[model samples]
Target: MTSPASPYVGRFAPSPSGPLHLGSVVAALASWLDARAHGGRWLVRMEDVDGPRTVPGADQVILAQLAALGMTSDDDVIYQSSRHAVYEAALARLTAMGLIYPCGCTRREIADSAPIHAVSGERPYPGTCRTGLQPGRGPRAWRVRMPAGVHCFEDRWLGRQCQDVAREVGDIVLRRADGQWAYQLAVVIDDADQGVTDIVRGADLLSSTARQQVLGQTLGLPLPRVMHVPLIVDTDGRKLSKQNGAPAVDTQAPLVALQAAWTALGFAPLPDASTAAAFLTQATDAWRLRWHIHPCSA
Candidate 1:
């Protein structure tokens, strides 16, 4: 049977490791624009999965920034740290399906493995723990066993992509060696739980989309539309990040920042578009036109 009708639900899930920098502002603004333009309800989720990394009061500051920029979500904010039970349930489901197993490979162990694959131009897991050791071992992490075969999906922007998760991703950790839940596991569960119909974010995360799609299938959740817009970079051409020390937006100049964001996507903003609503309307038309000219190759 075909999937249910896609809901008009969109979301912006950001981590609270630090303030919402310029790159984050672009992502938030873009998600907000697309949701509002379609008359959809946008929701905000605080991805505080790594408790050790999150800063106190960062979530409130992020929410405040959205409000100051005139981007309002439809529901109360969801914090990942507060949803441990939900993650436990999902982990139980995967465990029951025999898709999850204990992984004892550390970073050093993985790096020393013979066969490996590179992701995002860095270290890819070598599947050292895929089929190793007993289940109840001490201080082991949980990994989702990836199935063999080519997995593919058509991104709304990046076009058709195919990857063999078993080969490329290997057995990825669901729970960390440090007892922290992995991002891949948490994100898949959160998206399904939130009823997210679409995901729009920076191009930097494009590589993870394929693995997420596989996780969605295993969890019996609909594969949402994926769109990865251009990521903002620093003078050195490095992607702006919290570690890069990128400054957060002033919120008072959201319109200007929004304009820059649209421009980075290779779209032109309207001259008189001062308000958030007005800028979003123009951004929508620009996106449609761009997609029309260069449709997704999927």
Candidate 2:
């Protein structure tokens, strides 16, 4: 167990592209439970950097759903849209370090340039603009120059993990051509700014951890301990996501929805709890026990 004096901040960051689904609930519950178990502060961050995708009232809807589930942020909710200046400062710092450059390649250009052996399914940016932009091609986005080497970290659930960002992820975009802050850069800056010490989310984001870790290292920010729970997928084995048409969880019957999320996390449903508050208390207790028994303390 973490000492009371030790800082154990955790966060549940969700995009306002849609309402909270079962997948989102699972992630929220896990982060909430972890914060409770460790006697830490839990926060909610609205990842609405891409303004075009944000639904008008989705942030309030998401907050209401979490409240119905007996989970609330320890502090005021932070929206990514309001933090562009902070992100720009971080970008400026990186730019000053000569770690960033203008990217002139379009999606089609990268796809056409990628070699056949790119098994990662992502069209790795072939460093076409690493040296200088191609003639007549203006800058489309800003990309960070990834250094060559294996970046490794220990996941609380998945254990030891490693990835070569330079080879696999390539020069990732810091800002998209559309003038929106890319997720990779914004999330790193936000987590650090909010003093988030732990990140508990779905396994689908596991691949992104290494890239964020590298970016954090470059920015001299403290890396948060991470735990990626198994994703709740659909019948087709696809992870439930707004993009996949996963329906929003019922806020009106939040306790029942929480039960489903608990079950999805491999825990037996709490039969003794009647209300959302009682259920969350029981769930937090169960999680504390599991955390003590788990091999990775962080």
Best by lDDT: 2
lDDT of 1 by residue, 106-152 (tens): 67777777344554354566666567664655546888887788888
CA lDDT, every prediction?
0.78, 0.89
lDDT of 2 by residue, 59-120 (tens): 99999989888899999999999998998999999999999999988888888988643545
Give candidate 2 regions above 4 Å deviation.
1-6, 116-119, 293-298
How well does model 2 score by local distance difference test? Answer: 0.89
Query: How high is each candidate's TM-score?
Result: 0.90, 0.95
Report the alpha-carbon TM-score of model 2 versus the true structure.
0.95
Residue pairs with backbone overlap in model 2:
none
Model 1, poorest ten-residue lDDT window?
Answer: 289-298
Candidate 2 lDDT score at position 45 = 95
